[model samples]
Target: MNSGAPSSGLDTEGLYRVSGNKADQENIQLLFDKDHTVDFRSLGISVHSVTGALKSFFTALPEPLIPYEQQKSLADAVGIENEKDMITALQDVVKKLPQIHYDVFKFIITHLHRVYQHNQNNKMTSENLSICFWPTLMKPNFTDMASITATLVSRTPIQPFILHCPTIFRSRLEPNSFLQPAEGKLIDIEAEPGNL
Candidate 1:
């Protein structure tokens, strides 16, 4: 009487939360390959599709592993302005993250900065970034004792604000952050950091 494929309790209504297919595996490998370069725009990769692929890759891994604690520590360490200290702090944090998280986080740290730079040149906004990015890679709402609580609470798959809203969050920081000029100047601090 059933016309559809047989059910597998592993998935949801026949839809899998994660996939380990050949294509996905290749994407993941391409993402973190030490020798291979990953330029989304240069490679003609669709931003939306890239996010989907990243999510699939992350979900496909074994479970009971969220880097909430490690991510928090890393974030706090990265806050420090000292480069050497930051690297040491980052190393410590990396050691704390789960295996999958360490891989994903390292990949993100190395690659996401490029994506952010590209997005900046395109004048991409936070909402646009979210639409083009995925938050699962960074573990939404992740937290630990040493770091700030992750604020990625978006129901949408794309969560740039939580992931890294270079456009939007930067402005939020400007109004309150020390990046502003010590002497008051008649300029839009929120417009651009260097402009003021």
Candidate 2:
């Protein structure tokens, strides 16, 4: 994701709000399927294409990124009224995530937070990003009113989770960690992309 999103991505007004060309996104997806490591620039892939591919990847996962069993727990955590309690409850829910899910969630949320920081150009605030990602991250069974209500409320967490990532996932994001916010650097869009 970092490979194709640096210079142009920062200035993209809609960012994830817009869709990439279908053909271009499909090509990127094929490349990813063949090999996890893809050179985005070699194929002249656009940032939108990369972002689209990312969404596709998550959507195609056997289980939603947040997982079915944990959705209610996450929603309940987000519903906490107190700020500190909310963060604490959120942390507990996050701790229960599968390792791979937790890692990917942390990485993506962290990246989105950084993007939100440059919203003057990208215009993708945490709220906008949360809205965009809510469906992709989890899909709740809307079998009943309670489940529907819980899922609707669960959407609230995506924004706060992205904004308060450091506080919520402090243990996973230790000093000098790869997921550390300070470690983030701009990807040179002009340069050849690296493998994931």
Per-model TM-score versus the true fold: 0.37, 0.85
Question: Which candidate leads in lDDT?
Answer: 2
* Predicted candidate 2 versus true structure: per-residue lDDT over 139-166, tens digit per residue: 5557745447666785555887988877
Off by over 4 Å in 1: 1-47, 56-66, 81-83, 124-134, 141-196
User: In model 1, which range of ten residues has the least summed lDDT?
Assistant: 1-10
**In each prediction, how many residue pairs overlap at the backbone (N, C-alpha, C within less than 3 A)?**
0, 0
lDDT, candidates in the order shown: 0.39, 0.74
Any idea what lDDT model 1 has? 0.39
Candidate 1's error at 183, in angstroms?
48
Relative to the true structure, candidate 1 reaches a TM of 0.37
